[model samples]
Target: MEHKPLDQLRSVADVQPRPLSREERLQRWIDLLETDPKRRLSSLGEIEYKPPAERALLREDDSPLTVAYEDPVLRADGLSSDRLGDAMRYFALSDGQAHYALCSCLSGRTMEAGTCAQRLRNATGNVAWESAVGAWLLAALAVSLPGLVYLLS
Candidate 1:
């Protein structure tokens, strides 16, 4: 005689996975930030910085880092290489909108950069380090002419 198959198993309602502690989450963020840029960029959704319509197009040699350093507007705003590096590093660990903003800022796209700043501001909560980084980025952007205009309007 053929044996009957066992009944479908029911899922356990009480067997939920444990949530990550704050320390664990912070460690994870730090670990992600410490990873390579290509790897980190890939993990964070492979963001591409598109130039806005009103802005002059990017040159063939321009890259995110280069754009951050060489843009006259960004330079006029006093964005040093070190600060830009810090922003890039932080952006790599950040979510999509922040990445977009960082990329736009690097690309000299004022409107998109403003949008990115707003998104970053909305995201500040709970995590102290991330919030501090976000605040620094905001301060950096605020000094830029485009960013100042964005803030005004």
Candidate 2:
């Protein structure tokens, strides 16, 4: 094998694309999901106009389930793609909850109690009922905590 010239050498950083900012990653997910091409390109431009901090926070959510359900197509594409790992990390669900939610989302976008119970069993093996219930309860609490705190205070 011929050795590459110094001019032909490339750093690892150069070879590997820089990781996308949170805003761009979210926009990529939108690009994957949006059926309308114009709206997709338009969204890219819109995100650029946002302040960096606001754009960074566009995808942040206290509730994983809320993020998972925000857009059916985005969720479906994410669940099906390499972005599953990113989605899982961002959601911060426990392994059992992540698997169960992923399975349910893969099957359909809904995670209704009945379906969650059934999917949890199939996805999580033993003691799935409690895991599923706990996941639901935690997700509910995450969504409602601010309101509950305000109401109680």
Candidate 3:
């Protein structure tokens, strides 16, 4: 006789642990960025902007992964004091925080970075959060383009 599918796959008493809180998830993302060698080097000072010739060489559809900036406060909170000093040297303030107000002034456009970060932090779902983060990042980059060019040159 064919055995009936298990009526109850899990016991009623078996409770799944709650999903990670937003803060925890953010921390996890921070930790991943911090630990990965490539990611750790992807922060502002470490990246070299591709030259226009090189950029033209790439396929139109090829997009590089955007690296998230390390949040200074998060690193300080997560690391031991000794490690914190070394870690601090490698990380930058949260990109949203650093560029939020500056971008608005530079671009003659107005949008608060802190507000975007807060909205991203408080977002209840992934899609909204991702969009908020992307908007803030792109705005900041746009405002900084001229400076970036000078620095790279």
Could you say which candidate leads in lDDT? Answer: 2
Candidate order by decreasing lDDT:
2, 1, 3
Error of 3 at 74 (Å): 37
- After superposition on all CA atoms, how large is the RMSD of candidate 1? 18.5
Cα error, residue 126 of model 2, in Å, equals: 40
What tens digits encode model 3's per-residue C-alpha lDDT throughout 52-144? 344222221111112222444434444322221222223332434323212233323322333333333343236766888999999999999
The residue ranges of model 2 lying beyond 4 angstroms of the native Cα positions read 1-14, 36-86, 90-153
Q: Ranking by TM-score, best first?
A: 2, 3, 1
Write the residue-wise lDDT of candidate 1 on 41-84 in tens digits.
21121234343321223222223334344444334444344233
Clashing residue pairs in candidate 2 (N, C-alpha, C atoms within 3 angstroms):
none
User: Whole-model lDDT for model 2 versus the true structure?
Assistant: 0.43
TM-score, prediction 2: 0.24
Estimate TM-scores for all models.
Answer: 0.22, 0.24, 0.23
Decoy 1 TM-score against native: 0.22
